[model samples]
Target: MSVNVITYDVGTTGIKTCIFEISDTIKLITAAVEGYQLYIEENGGAEQDLKEIWNAMCSTTIKVIDNSKISPGSIQGISFCSQMQGLVLVDKNGEPVRRLMSYMDQRARRELKEGMGNGLKISGVNFLKLLKSIKITGAVAASVKDPVWKYNWVKRNEPENFKRVHKWLDVKEYLIFKCTGNFIMTKDSAFGTMLFDIRKGKNCFSSKMCKLLGVNMEHLPQIAGCSDKVGLLTEKAAVQLHLKAGTPVFGGGGDASLIGVGAGAVSMGSTHIYSGTSGWVSTVVNKRVLDITSMIASIIGADDNSYNYFAELETAGKCLEWVKNHLALDEINIYLQKICVSDSLESLYVNLYDFMLEEIKNIPAGSHGVIFTPWLHGNRCPFEDSLARGMFFNISLETGKRDLIHAVMEGICYHLRWQLEAQRKKIKTSKAIRFVGGGALSPLTCQTMSDILGCEIETVDSPQNAGALGAAVIVAVGLGILERMEDADKLIKVKEVYVPNTANKEIHDRNFIVFKSLYKNNKRAFRIINK
Candidate 1:
């Protein structure tokens, strides 16, 4: 029998609720998104209101169910995957004690330095600390974004609130608690905390590491496997979400881990690239691995027995949004006024993204020698530099607005290429990489990435919903509807394939060389400028 499931993808920018029909193939019946604000401050503060996030999740779930015209009783399971490394503290009542510190937040830099001391910094942990972390956890990032640092930030800065905390939950665990009334953390989510022993034979929270961070063991949530059935949806949560009471709720995973499963990259060496508000390239691997120099490491995969080697980029499609808000004044004014100049103009404003994609199509490759660096937010992988800033290089008098736009898109691809090479150093990535995220919506960008990487790229249906689909697949596996996570390979349907354009190979290769050199030449200067 076929099963329908609701998979909530709680992302950095918003929450996307996707309803899937899991049968011979997984089909997205419908989806709805509700956005919430990330309270970002100039002093490296990025936070989200937990109450607002929960409300968005409830509302979007209802919207998706109503829009899909599906019966709530027909839904067999519900699960979730969310942005990783966020620190969410909750009291005994399972209510958030404070606004969440986002994975993007860097306010804990000072604390991270204190804990790890000054050494060759990669992922927050220094050389000595990283070796220790690798010996225990299989991965470690000492960045301010790591949950442990965020926890310390709270302990030092918000002691009153921290003292009231009953449990430490990542975004996914909080959502799971809301649905199932179970305070459980998935193994994949635990990986982001830098507190888990990610070693293949010992994937559990490390008590020694907790002591190192001066954290109480009781504050951590109970760890569960990704496919473990935590509990059933409580009657209270079901009423709010308009779903059937007692539906099985499975522990999903961290967004990066689930994205691999969602894109059917569960097999070893299979690779996938995701571009959302943030971006990453993840490959499934047989065992744990860590590359401190490249700032890439194997985090826990959705499959309990495996790992996902991932490289992160702080911004991807978000760069386009930056352009829309700052560079596209005319487009913004039209949007603000809601004025219709013509029927086509109305359509253009309504679907400005489609218009942008069409514009990108007309622009030729290489952006006529203009190169853009997509580091609007400091980079995370392939070299962790918080000071790196985005730039447009090799611009000339002949460069047009279209060239600038195309260059920005190309810049993101270049960053992805850099990340890919870093991961390639540790593992054998698949020749054909799967693409999933908002960026995959653009045929031009997909093709550009193919040419830039000199490899084949595959995008699947509703690519941006990969995280959601992966969550549902996890639920299915937990409920015995599917035999294993690998069954996802048969369920995922590819939308299109983009092959390398040999015609643009020479120019892109040259541009990539310049891209790598740009960073090496500017590292010291970046620190000076940002400092």
Candidate 2:
């Protein structure tokens, strides 16, 4: 009577593998995390080692099964939720041709500009092309961070690689192919490419948009339904993962979509905020919506025949990682080395984030007038400015490390607040928004988000595991273990609720005006200085 599913959540910074019991109320049996390095270079180049990612996935899956003492045979299926917009090119042999270009990469700014020049004029995209794109896709951003730009960049810069590429797969699809020997991606993953007819909600590429973008559609993979079983796990992959062979592999979804499902946002009009490496404010909606000005747009959702209205911030937990690496690592290394830890750097890096959260709890809202910008790698939503840079404005002599730290957290919350405001312009949001992500694990961030946004913030147990759970839920639905994805509402148990602090509302409101103006005031300057 015991049935389980292993879901792998492949995020930008790492992979988290979780095992879930398939039932009326899904239970998370156990989980394990495996980390990887992101190679970031000047002029907006960010990449990941694809081989290491596969290794991380396999190792983490083994760790979860071994740690939980669960029988691999009991696992009815396997699925995935992965970071969207990353481009992974593979050869005819299904081997990675090169490292993946991350969603964080902004190298195609020039190309995006060239596309939207006198021949066209829609800021990031061509005006005429934009019209058709908006009509069919429901959303279109001609940014270098999008997979289309990455594909174009590869074709232009590495012509040899482009010719050799047998398929252009998103991160999740690459992993799926590794397990099932099928080159496939879900509608949600394809939506991230900005080359799909989102309005039609088709599980295939858009030839019209591809023609406009000058992208060869031949390189793309076949699109599949979010919960459709793609194929059975291969014997080779089963041996590597220490799992049973012939396990069903379902077509999972993009990280944001799955996270929405995992956060119990399966019903229309339900909303949730996820802060992982990147962050977003997403709401499930029945109708397609697009707001290019506010950068709030519709993308394919994990649930069948649904869409998600969202605005994304490119950096969230990533900013915190920046702080840890640049600001706190030295002190942490010394402390850990004193404790005789062999790998002090890694040890401090892994365990110090929770410590940082504990320290942030004592700081008040607004960080005592020290406002930080969470745009270290530029922003994607509430505006489409890639040249924007992160800053800790209004720092005074009285400011301390705690203030700087809290400001970073508050800065991310402020951006989310901006996104929430933009999303409210289109539709009604839920009374209480659920929060899920690795970043959502921090009580301080949740409280800060609630205080700044003036809304109730709900947290579920294992917030970091939301994407993984969502992927498993999709598998359960595909296998008829669950009737509907909406049942996630009953499956997800709310572990905590963060109420807004009324006393701090005035400062947040006052600072929000300043926060809103800071970008506009510096827009020209950022373009000049950064470019």
Candidate 3:
């Protein structure tokens, strides 16, 4: 018998809610997406209104259920796979005391410097603090953007809001509270906070680490495994979402842990690369691998026994979105007007990205010496620099619009290659990496990425919905429809593979060497201008 489950893949800008029928095979019945705005401040702050986020999820859930025509009682459960490391401080009533501090927010530099960058230091972190943190939590809070720093920023800046904080939660955990009226953080989300002790906690939050970090232990929620049942959907949430009140709610995990399961990259050493609003390269490992220098930390994934060595890009396909709004306005409006195509203006807006890729398909491999950085919203992984901004380098009068556009795509591929290089230093990556995301839908991206990384790239079916699929897999395990996460590998198969293009290797390699130097060469300039 088939059981229906709804999974929410909540991202930085939006929530994608998908309903799937799980039985002999996992099949997507219907899906709906709703977007919310991320508020940016001049002082390097990025936030989102709490009510806006919850409304998006509610609307999308209702839309998905209504579109699927699935009965409220037929839906068995709900789970989530969302962006990690965001700070959502809630009061006892589960209401936010302040706007959400996005993972992209870096306004905590002062707090980070005072808290972890005092007296003596080793590799940008105070030695004693790093040692104590590493001993207890297997990682240290070095980045100004870490949730701990944001917490400190709140305590110091917004003292009134800080006083009412009943529990600190990640993005998805906050949403889960709305659905089930339970206060719990999944293991992966807790680990993202750099407060959970991997050595001794078992599943408990470590008081030693919490004390060392100067955190309020009273605020930390109980940790839950990804497959554990969180609670049943409450009547209030049920009315809002048009779902059954008693439906089960599972402990859904962060995107870094669950997307690999969706991509069928759950085996040891199996690597999967994702590009969405943000991007990441995660490989499942039997043992933990933490390289503070590279900023690639192995996370406790869905299964208790394993880890995901994860590297991230703060902005990925978001660069393409930037291009659509800023760079390609003329082509989309005037060119479409000239073509006088049968597709409506709304349809044209939906297909504009396809139009951009098709126009740049014939551009040369190297983009004729033009290079564009994909740091529109700063950067993470390999390097974490919030001051960094996107730029077009080596542009000449001869550089046309198409060449500049193609170079942006090439730059994104180059960064992914750089991340893979950094990760390869610590662990053995898969021979051929599975690529899943909205970026995977582009054949040009798949081919270019394979050539740039000098490895094979495989795309799974419905690559854009991989996170939703991953959350559905977790719900299936919780519902007893699947025995374990590994079983998902049998059901999700690769749809197509792109081999490295030998002819384009030299140019790509040459551009990548230049790409690596751009950030290093302009580090001081970035801080001076943006700071």
Candidate no. 3 TM-score: 0.97
Residue 428's C-alpha lDDT in candidate 1? 93
Worst 10 residues of 1 by lDDT: 331-340
lDDT against true structure, model 3? 0.89
Kindly provide the TM-score of model 2 when superposed on the true structure, using C-alpha atoms: 0.95
Better of 1 and 3 by lDDT: 3
Candidate numbers, best lDDT first, in rank order:
3, 2, 1
Instruction: Give the per-residue lDDT digits (tens) of candidate 1, residues 298-376.
Output: 8777886677888899888888888766764474464545643578776664466666667668787788988888888
Those runs of model 3 whose alpha carbons end farther than 4 Å from true positions after fitting are 331-350
Measured by lDDT, the strongest candidate is 3
Worst 10-residue lDDT window for candidate 2 reads 332-341
TM-score of each: 0.95, 0.95, 0.97
Steric clash pairs (candidate 1): 123-141, 123-142, 124-142, 124-143, 125-142
Error of 1 at 68 (Å): 2.5
By descending TM-score, how would the candidates be arranged? 3, 1, 2
Please provide, for model 3 over 186-260, each residue's C-alpha lDDT reduced to its tens digit, 9 standing for 90 to 100: 999999899998884456788887887779999999889999999999999999989999999999988888889
Q: Higher-TM-score candidate among 2 and 3? A: 3
Query: Could you give candidate 2's per-residue lDDT for residues 1-531 as a string of tens digits?
Result: 547899999899899999988766788998888899999888789999999999999899989989999889988999999888898999988998889999888898766766554474755556887788888777775566877888888888998888899998999899989998999878888888888776444546889888878888898788888999999999999999999999999999888889988987788888999998899999988888888778788787877667889889999989999887777567546554454334756565457787777767888878899998898888888888788999989989999888998888889999999999999999888889999988888887888889999999999988888899899889888988778888878888789999999999999999999998999999999999888
Model 2 Cα displacement at 259 (Å)?
Answer: 0.4
